[model samples]
Target chain A: MTNSQNNSSVVDPRGPKPRKIMSRRNIILYGTLLVVAIYYLIPLYVMIVTSLKGMPEIRLGNIFSPPVEVTFEPWIKAWAQACTGLNCDGLSRGFWNSVKITIPSVFVSIAIASINGYALANWRFKGANLFFTILIFGAFIPYQIMIYPLVILLRDLGIYTKLPGLILIHSIFGMPILTLLFRNYFTTIPEELFKAARVDGAKFWGIYFRVMMPMSLPIFVVAIIMQVTGIWNDFLFGVIYTKPDTYPMTVQLNNIVNSVQGVKEYNVNMAATLLTGLVPLTVYFVSGKLFVKGITAGAVKG
Target chain B: MNSIEINNLSLNFGDVKVLKDLNLSVNKGEFLVLLGASGCGKSTLLNCIAGLLEINDGQIYINNQNVTWFEPSERGIGMVFQSYALYPQMSVKGNLSFSLKNAKLSKDEIEKRVKHASEILQIESLLDRKPAALSGGQRQRVAIGRALVRDVEVFLFDEPLSNLDAKLRTELRVEIKRLHQKLDNTMIYVTHDQIEAMTLADRIAIMRDGLIQQLDTPKIIYSNPVNKYVAGFIGSPGMNFLKGKILQDGKPIFKLEGGWCESPDLSNYKFQETIKVEKEVWLGIRPESVVVGGEAENMPVNFNLEIEVFEPMGADTLVWSQIGGQEFRFMVDVNTSINVGGTLTVGFDPAHASIFDLESEERL
Candidate 1:
């Protein structure tokens, strides 16, 4: 066909193809993404370098350079015996305590959130929508705000300064966000699914446990990561709600870095902070890949 | 294993009554299709029968028990969803075995059932892959396999083919038909596609405005729609309508006031319901029944009109024209020598035409 007859009026050779134009946008996006990437990396780099350096190098120098004298002493001190108050117990004590609080808390919170999310999205009972709106609003409220009443409530219930109390507090505090995340995720699931599940003779709990929970592994991993990180790095709740014995990694990190002294042990502080962030960070890195794939694959087009 | 009877089922989401006193029944082992446009409550009705939706006032009987409040599992039904909602974390074998696992069946029995279902759907190799690893058609097969493992008395399909590509849709449609035959259980399917309804349904229930307008065999629904809505919904290109005056006599005759076609002979049709109301009456004629024929004396009522557009669809061609400003369509053989802006004589066979009351739009 002739060029004129080719309908150039309807088609421009250089104009974007809906599919092909992504790479151009990706270059611009990735450039900006790189800058943001560096912004996060700088502080992490400072912490790492300071954690490895000797006392003299840590005191006198740029936070970016390699440590003048790298030593494993801070790592050991931070693990076994690091002083928060009178006792010089390092992050290791709180590290175990954090694990104890996080595992059960994340599992309970994520499980409740998934159930709440599915029920709210699929079943419409009396006052169900109002409950959801209230729950979402509750989740958005700054978690620290609840500490005052929660401390008194837990104290009166005679469970304050206990590990179970800390776990309970973590579950209640993390529930709103977990619930919101899960509900938003589940709302995107096709209604045909719930219908089909029921047809398979799945009851409400049956559908939730057998169908929704199984279908939602990626989101569950994400929820676990979020709750673990939030509770693991938690300072205010761990310090106030739990006893010294039940204090999480964040409290120990706080004592290691924030001890009342003129020149703090920057190396130990960095090492302790790194120690505190490991579990949540590890949780994130491990499941982050499948979390993304799960969200897109099982959740979206399905 | 058992028949389903839905009686006066009415459901409302807030003030909008979605299924307004809807009624339909599926005989034992019959593939009943609830066909309607979206929002016409076909899926809603199917959900109600599946015990997924609670009807405000109705009785759903499965094998003679009033199961209005029965739980879905207790009601013994299997439903295939349009989305093929498979559990992501589970292997295909795990997904197929899930319900059986819930039923506390022995592990060996569950394995045996899963193996049987996978072999039937020809998805045996995909047993180890998760739902995320499968394509759309494969996921759908797995979804069907999940339902098959349930081994329930009733099977419900809520637009299961809507998500598939056209070619895959045709392939899966045949697969589903074969499954239905092999399983021989009561299947209640809901779809908006008339072709799907025409091909798969043992009986088609045409729905409109939250009511079952007509529930009959596909042949009866195509040839004898209860009203204009049923007539309009069940055919591709749909039945054409024209305002015509009814001719007086026992044998019903209608004159096309501004139509190119004159009055046709309806000598065979005896208007069963005697009604003198004929002003502005609607005439429903299927495109297949109306055709391009020869001269006037050879045909009783005929139209000689300009062909505005022609669409050749391989097997047959659709010729569109306007008579008295009302658009009309007629089917012609694909090999027919016809061109745009050309005038052709089209004939209407009164034997196949239907008359509708204008105000009510119900077939008389």
Candidate 2:
């Protein structure tokens, strides 16, 4: 190389140097993170291995060992033939039930809360603050306190022990936080945009549909992630509101895993447990980036 | 006929009166700029005209129709905001055609309007790009196009250039001025920048404390300011004032701390009331009008002052000095060889200087 090129290749004393991969700091940092990863993965490891083992091997008693004799019998049993009370049909019934509850509940809750949030953020009615304050505080109240009252109300509406009753219950409980998430997100939008929409000849519903709804995709994804996980995992409302035949996955999982039957099928229980958690896990993994971004942007601003 | 007229408009937020009994009128195809500092209600007034604000008491007429109680869209006006406010999820073409689609315009009409606007703005290549992919200037052009497609009789701008950098602000400012000329639509613009107001306005309304202080053509407002506030606000390196008193002896002389000079002949000078001796006044003169060096030697009115500093500004030099113990600065041609602490004689026309009553701050 020429003299100038040689000089350029030489390291400058003031500039940062590249770090070695095996540096003491990197070892300590990544070592601590690796330990954490193993700690979290252990239970998942046990679940998969246990579910693959037959009952006789499960009784041989090393829960974390890879199954010596692997079989798909437990998975098939979890899907079709395990008993959850008198109905011998397995989690498929409850899986489909959870699907029915989750879809409408997610859509209905997000639709109502987003519009409610838009109104609260932009349109100021008299005593709106009073009602909003109550709603926000209501989010902290224990669901148990309102359960009995909701049961009476649903009975009056003739949706008691019905899927719609549980859907309504999930939407009602989801309102406060979903509204807060959406309201905070919508307020971050410039006030001038709302005014511009109005000036463009949009009224209340027109602005919501044309302007606010389209710009709010990230927050909607965040809302969907929240509602899906929440409603899918909900056992209290499902147990209280639905008949045994209409039980959601969580309630059915409980009956299948813990019921005092002829014999406790541990492998089938582990497989069923893993199956029930799969929907939320899939949603979380798929929406991981947007979920983080949405929360960061939707964080409350003054 | 007037394109817009507001009479006796007032607005209040609780105890604070943001605008009070304000009245204004815009001739058809007129470009009126509302100029003020922050919180002077310039934007508020524009909002009222656009029907974005509900007035406490007033009548607003647009194109000879009373639109005081009408919705903003029904009032037949379009607006551009400082933030640009393009719908983020939409592409440039979608943003431009969104409102038209809402108004139930036919697809061909929407396409034609969008095409014409993009062509006029030279933003044809940007139609498919999302706002996130566009630069600030491109997003602003799409915003302006959004209003353009509305085809309204009046266009309102609320400090639309404030969010841009200086270079882009100037570029978009010229583009807006060109748009106004080509469309021949009445436009009302709001800005705190005096240069933007002075360059773009056909008639400028200078406001303070929620009131229109003075409304006139840029030349009239600049050359003949009505009061001390107007004189100080219109010019860059704002008008310099030497506190003094009017000496009505012999020939109406103005006496300052260091010395005195002949006051402009006030025989025909319009005064709200008759002038008297010992009346405290502020004598105001713009920096560019202050003559320096050889030009000062033959003046009928002059001051011999010591230069505290001289700034060489390429095109012209700004010389800072003190007169009567108060700081004063004046501009001179760049060729002048002046140094710090040097003495220079400066002159100005008494006719061009303004004398305001110190107590009321109004012109005498």
Q: DockQ for each candidate?
A: 0.52, 0.74
Give me the displacement of residue B42 in model 2, in angstroms: 1.2
Docking class of 2: medium
Residue B229 CA error for candidate 2 (Å)? 2.0
After aligning candidate 2 to the native by TM-score, how far in Å is the CA of A134 from where it should be? 2.4
Worst 10 residues of 2 chain A by lDDT: A8-17
Writing each residue's lDDT as its tens digit, candidate 2 over A67-92 gives: 99999899999989999778989999
lDDT of 1 by residue, B1-364 (tens): 3499888888998899898877767799999998998989888888888777878998899988888999877887887888888877789988888778778899889988999999999999999998999999999999989988888888888899999999999999998999899989889999999999999999998888898888899999888887888888878888899877887665556766775446666676646577573556788888888767563335567768789999998899999988787888989888779999998888776767888888888877
lDDT of each: 0.82, 0.90
In terms of lDDT, the poorest run of 10 residues in model 1 chain B is B291-300
Off by more than 4 A, model 2: A1-16, A300-302, B257-272
